[model samples]
Structures are given as structure tokens and as C-alpha cells.
Target: MTEISRRALVQRLVASTAFVSGASPLSAAPAPNRSPPPPAPPGKFEFDDVVRRARDLAAAPFEPVAPPLPDALNKLDFDAWRDLRFRPDKAFPIGDSFQLQLFHLGHLYRRPVTINTIRDGIPTPIPYSANLFDYGRTKLDKPLPVNLGFAGFRLHYPLNAPKVFDEVIAFLGASYFRVLGRDQRYGMSARALAVNAGTEAEEFPFFREFWIETPESGADRATVYALLDGDSTTGAFRFDIYPGVDTAIEASVTLFPRKPGVKFGLAPLTSMFFIGENDHRFSSDFRPELHDSDGLLMHSGTGEWIWRPLRNPPKPEVSSFLDKDIRGFGLLQRDRDFDHYQDLDLAYEMRPSYFVEPRENWGEGRVDLVELPTGHETSDNIVATFQPKDSPEPNKPFNYGYRLIASLNPAKLSPNGRTLNTYQTTAAALGSPEPINPGSRRFIIDFVGDDLRYYFSDPQLVEVVPSTSQGKIVRSFIVPNPHTKGFRAAIDVQLEPGQSTDLRAFLRSGSRALTETWTFPWRAS
Candidate 1:
């Protein structure tokens, strides 16, 4: 098998089996017998109780647990794991609006998590059964234990079709969960909290237990409560998720740190960026771009919208924008044209862009973007989060709340104008004869919206405000795009050798801003 296929096969195998064992497949060992734990006490299962439990757990050192998979069952490959499907009839019913599905433990997911159903303020653990799964090609000579916990959980609802149920949200990896809007596929992932990200000693806090509240009949929303545990931090998170054309999750988080001065990242998003219009690493048979997200969109407190295109660089790069009481930020997949992504199966055009809007003032901090080098698009290499300027003191409690909007449409923070596209070409093409020079680069930026069209049509009405550091502007022009009905700006810049340039541009009509500020970084080779 090829290397890619072999790796995929191994991941599938590991994802399906709960554990690895050296025991014989036919040898039947008596299943471990254990009593069912008592249900959570009444009125003792409030959100504060969840936080208290997490804080208690964080007071102790981190303890890793091993999955309980029999050696015979652990040896099952991807195909075998696929055969072990969950029985449809045994699916957990969560009111009329949503249902719950459990993922089995195996290769990719070895850590088992506790799943509980909260009904009328009480928490009840859901026990696992071997019969709940239909082991397809894998032969199981002996029955499995009943207490085998789940790997993770997925939330399902009528997302696209009326009669068919689709998975809208999922909680799997370390405190990581993904949600999809109507007709939108998963792209970026959001975490409950991030501690020490982009640092040499980073920590991944995980959701060890989840409490899914049973929805009422005809309810349009579902509530999920989770307990986050890490080496130095503990948190309680409550998510009120509404799935639709624009799926939204309103989250309230309370964190207690085991150690003081821990850097906390709020509303953190993770994605992948292999190549795009700005950075084309390899020649491919498909379209010109391949990425989960194209740019980082931010709405500053001053009501200015900023678009920063994502890049896959040769080394790790971290950029931070300091702001106080920020409004919102997200990783957007603005390019929705199917022609942009030739791969019809993955449907990159239909992937959702997640925006995090703070409900209240978040004080002072910086929106940090981290881009890492990746050889392929399959690996996630982009991270964006809000890093607080002041670290929370150890043993001190902190609370943060935010609303996440997941949609296929671009965020409408302003009705005026926004960035449509950004591209780079040879500066020499713009009247320069030195076509082989590496320092000469021309950038083309397009701004679209109703305001731009209104301002540009009047003579001497609109002017392009452009600035650059460490570069000289050779030529600049603004014109209307006949195809898109938008204002396009083209600028030729000559960068100094061994120097990087930061370019900023915006459209204004007599001091009235017509478009969002466009900022980009150019590094000379």
C-alpha cells in the first residue's frame, strides 16, 4: 500500500479499536464485573457543582488513564472497525429536536470519556453495551464488558433535509468541539480554553466528561455542559447550541487555575492552511487554492473591519493585534465558488466560517494568529485566539462568555464595504522591464459593497489611502471591476532587499471610510 493509504488505514484501525492487546482472539476471559455508580444527587448537579468538581480535579496532578480494549478486539483494522457500527435503534433519544450518537474507542481515539445525560437537574451515566455495536468483519468470540465508556459524542438534528438527521456538533479531541451550520461542512474547530498556546511548553486541556441536557419536546436548542481538566487549569463550560443556516453556540466558561499566572486563550479556533492565491507551494491538477480557511476577519472596537489573509510559511509565524474590548474575530472561508476548489467530495466551498462575538467587554488583549508549515492540507496548521494581556493569577477564578456564529456567509459587521479578494503578481508587469527581479511584486486588492460603488461613481469623490513600510510604491490605481461591480485597487511595490513590508490600504471619500482597512505583509526573498 502507498504511504498515504497505509497511514489512513492505520488511523482508521486505531480509531475503531478501543485498545491494543496481545491476547488470543478466541480465548474468552470473564468480563470484569462492576456495580453501576449511583446517580448524581438531586440539586447537586448545578453548573457551579461542575466547576467545583473541575477545580477539585485540577488541584491534583494530571493522571492519564488507559483504555480497556481486549487484545483481540484491539487488533481490528480500519475495515474491521467500520464493521463495528453502532446499532441505529439503540441511538440515544434527546427530545424531538436532537439526538445523541456515541463514537467507539479505537486507534485514533484511545482516551475514553464519560458521557452523562442530565434530566430535570440530575445526571445519569450512560452505560455501554457490546450489543450496541455491530462488529462487521471483526470476529468477537467473547462478549465485551458493559462499562466500556465512549470515545466521544456527536449531536444530530435535521440540518439539511427534513426527514434525514445530520450531525451538527461533535465533542472529541482535547476540549475541542466542532459545529456545522445549515448545509455547511466542518472546517475550523473551537476549543473550550487554550493555555500557553504558541509557546514552547503548550498544554492541551481536555474535556474529560460531558453532561448533555435532555431537550424538551419541540425545543429548538440543546444545552451541553462539560468539565475541562488539564495539568494546570480546570474549567466548566456551558454551551447553548442552535443549529440552522447559521449555527450559533453561546458559551459561558468559568476557569480555576492550579498554578498562578497562566495564559488563557478564549474562543480559540484551529484550522489548516496549505496553500492559496498568495502562497502556491506545489503545482496541482486541481484549482489554484486549497485550505480550510482563507483569512482572519476582525471587527475592532473602533468599528473598523480588518481582513488578514492567511499564509502557510516556511517556518512558524505568530502575529498579534492588540485591542481593548474587541468586538469579534473569526477564520472565514470567503471563497465559495465551486470552481475555486475542484475537489467535489470534500466540498471546500461549503465549509463554514466560525466567528466569535463577545457578548460583553473582554478588557485588553491581542488576537493572535499562529501559522505553521504543513506539507499537505490534511494536517491542521493554523490557530487563532484571544490572548489576555494579563495572565490570571494562580488559584484565582476567572469567567468569560462569548457567542460563536458558524455560517457560510461572510460576517456582516458593516454594511458598507469589505475585502473581496487579494492577489500578488510580478511588479515588472506594471511597466517595469526587470521581470526576473525577486523584489518587485505587485498586489491587487478588491473591495466590494454598496458603499464603494456609490462613492466611486462620483468624480473626485473617492480616494485610495495606501501606505507601506520598507517599500516604495511605484504605481497605484483604483478602478471598477466590470465583472463583480466592485472597486478594485492595484498597487506596484518594490521591496528593499532582506526587508519585510507591511502594507495598509483603505478607500475613503472626503474622510468618510468606504471600505475596510486592508493589511498585508510582504517578505522579500
Candidate 2:
């Protein structure tokens, strides 16, 4: 399927499972099983137990269980599917600060995922029942299956206010899940794995079952484990989630590949870049810009910081940054000004940026950025992930760990000066009589930081360094921007027709660097 169709399908699935308000909190009976077998002994369940299951599954041939939806739900539309809302009164209380809600299966979400609650190292299945939901306005032609299971689930906590519980994280479709910080709206998502992403034979690895551990009564964090299954691989995952002003999730993943030489993208991030400061192709909208993430930020092993501005290319584009023992990377929404987006309801300015800090050494790998062509703002089209130099041996355990931070504060992620804005225009200055050269482009990059303020007094001491892979740099210089209290780097480049260039620029003061390297890929029409 095309990227557009894939995104559209996910959007529909997400809309069908959005949360709805309930009347009051009420306690319900223990979730009855679907004639389940005897439960495992207490204290026998742990991370190793899930790993054993993944290994056994990988040893066998892959079996898909895409059961057809019931007639009552298969024909339902968006609004109809959304009407099957899980009762908030039925929310499972994990501790004093956390509660869990389930999603009903319907619409584009046809496959069912098994959910279990782990207490005292004992797992209990949460069965499906019509009484668990309130189907409003939609008439059911037949009763649903007892083993219908769930589409996915979400966790709630007091993130913003003390009394009222707000949604902190949600796992709804595929191997996709999104988390939010205090005061931030949902934006991008973090996936378990991406197999052959941005290619015709791309595969999606999904979580077939989940085990959520009940935290202690006064505990501040929750632990959830998952068993992932795909045609290419089987894996186990553990998320120790801490929700607060800056929500952090410590993730431990173990993958057992089913086939040899299959490309895998670990700790993948998926987002949208419909329009942004660097993309000026679409200007008919009243809002100036719309995007979940504006750029890809990475810290290489050699201690170099690079920021690549995202673009909505006319065709698919993929860029890879080779590294060794990589430190960290993320998709960031740096433009927090509300005026820049002119969007009130969506609150694009309040979207959180997700940064992934590796907990274990990821040796000799490349961070890949995939930008798919997108015409609408609703569907996500950007993906970033880390691919190792060597593929994991089939049916063997491949372990990795990372900390995923979803925060609104982007400054703490890096210490040096960061890219403030990136603008592209014609080579000729505005209102100048110089003939327009369509093949020539001028890029202006502004950087801001505390260290840059010290250089304001000696602006001429800072130099602008620009480089291009397939173009000639006509001119490059640095100038002071009094308004932002920073310096702007401007570069003019001339490119041959149909030629593409990978451009990079940074600022330096004598022997010291002042800002992170700003990179962008440009193609002459």
C-alpha cells in the first residue's frame, strides 16, 4: 500500500478509539476469562518469561490471526465505531495515581490484541463483554464474540491536575504508541520496530498481547510488557513509564528475527510534516504552518550535534547519518510560538518532542530519516529510526535499551546553540532588480543560545561555515540579529537543473563551535 493509504487507515483507526467522558467512577467485578486455562503460578512471571515466549514463537513458522470482524462492526463507519465507548467507570485502577481503559475493536482496527493485568507476578486476562461499553445510537444486529478481545488500550494519570486524571499514554494501532507530557497535546508516536520502512515491501510488526503490571498503591510509575509478533520477527518489550511534567519511558526490547538478512529499524519514531517554515510550497491555507515535528535532531558518537530540517518532498526522500556508539536522537517540534501556526484547537505549539537516549551502547549504526510525500496534514509521513550495520542472526535474541523522553522543553535536550529558524528563498534579495535565477537558492539559518549572547559584542569574530554535497556555494556569511540576540548564517548556492544537494552549515568562533550543524536537502526543479 502507498504511504497515503497507510496513513489514512491509521487516522481512521485512531479516531475510532479516542477517549470519551463518563458519568462517574464505579468498581466492577473481576474480568471474567474466555474459558481460559489455569493461570501461571505467582512469582513466575517476569521479563524473562516474555522473552521465552518470543523465542519459542520465533522458532516456529509465522501464523497470522486476522479474524474477520463481526457483521455488527465490519460495516460500521467512523462515528458508529466511535460510539462503542469503553465505560470510564470500568477503568482499571493500577494504583492511587493510575487507571487503565480499553479500546473496542471495530472500523479499521480489525485484529484483536489480548490484554492482561500482572499483580504479584500473576497474569489475569481481561475478557471482552458488551457490558464493558456503552454503544450509543448505533444498533447492534448481533451480539459480539466473548473472546473478541480489545483493539488496544490507554493509561491515565494526574498529569496536569491533581484531582482529575488525564491520558498520559495510549497504544491503539500496530506497534504504535504515543505519550504526552504535562500541558502537551498528542503529536508523534513511538513504534517498537520498523521492518523495511519506506520501501515497497515494508512490514509492520504489531503487539499481539500486552501484560500491564499493577504498581504499588503509592508508586509513581507503571510497568507494562508486550509480546510483539510479525511476519519477519517476534519480540518482547518492557516499558517502565513515569508520568509528570516531562514523561519518561525506559524501554527494554528483545527481538528474535524469523528470517535472515531482514532489515530492521529499532526504536522507530513516526510523525507528520505537512507544512513547516522550510516548506513553502503550500500557502493557500490561513494558518502559516502545520506539523507534528519540524526537524530531526541527533547527537553523533564523535560529539557532533546535527539538526536536519524536515520537508514534505514531492517524492519520497531518505537520508542516513552514519555513527558509532550514538548518544541520542529525536524528532523535535521546536517552533513553540502560537502565532506561527495560528492554530488554537490543535495547539500545535503545545505538542511535545520525543527524545530517545540510548541506555546501552548502539555500536556502528546509522540513523535513518524517511520523509514520504504528504498533501494533507492529517496523515503522518515522517519516520526516523536506528539501523545497525549488521542484521541480527535469525531466531536469536537481539537486545537493546533506551529512554524515551516526551517533553515540551526542547532546550534541555542539548547544551549548545540550536537552530531557531530556517528560511529558503530566491538567490536575489527581495525587491532587488537582479534577474531571478530559478536554479539558485538562498538559505538563511538563525541560531539562539546563552553562549551566543556573549558573541553579540564581537559579532565579526563568528564565522559561517557552509558545505554542499552536489552544488557550488556562491557566498556565505554571518550577521547579527539584535531581535533574537543571536547570529544568522546565510548561504547562496547554485545547482544544476534536476540536481539535488545535501547542504550543511554551522557557526564557529575562532577555534570553538557556537551552534549545532544545520542540514537540509534541496533539489532544483
Deviation from native of the Cα of residue 51 in model 2, angstroms: 0.5
Per residue, candidate 2 scores C-alpha lDDT tens digits across 1-525 of 121125534332322222211111001111222232234465668888999999999998887767777877777777998998989999998877799999888777777899999877788999898988999988897888789989899999999999888999998878889999899999889898888765655777788899998877877788889999989999999988889898988888999999888889888998899888877786579899999999999987777888988988766667788888788889999999999999989989999999888877788878888777677888788888988889999968999988888989888877889998999988877799988776899999999995999989999889998988886998888889998999988999989998878888889988898888898877788
Error of 1 at 394 (Å): 1.5
Candidate 2's C-alpha runs over 4 A off are 1-42, 435-438
* Candidate 1 Cα RMSD (Å): 10.8
TM-score per model over all chains: 0.88, 0.91
- Can you write out model 1's per-residue Cα lDDT over 1-525, one digit (the tens) per residue? 111122122122212212111111000111113232235456657677788887788777877555557666567666765676777778788887888988776645556689999877778988988867877767878766677787789989999998778999998766778899898888778888877777754677777889998866887788888988877788899888888888888788888888877788899988877778766765564677788899988887776777888887766666778787788888999888888788778888888898888867888888887777667877787788988889887676788888888889884544558887898888755575665556877888888885665655662677778878666877887887766677778878777687777777888888788887788777777
**Cα distance off (Å), candidate 1, residue 232:** 1.5
When summed lDDT is taken over every stretch of 10 residues in candidate 2, the lowest stretch is 20-29
For this target, which candidate reaches the highest TM-score against the unseen true structure?
A: 2
Compare the candidates by lDDT and give the number of the best one.
2
State each candidate's clash count.
10, 0
Candidate 2 Cα deviation (angstroms), residue 263:
0.6
Q: Please report how far candidate 2 places residue 279 from its true position, in Å.
A: 2.4
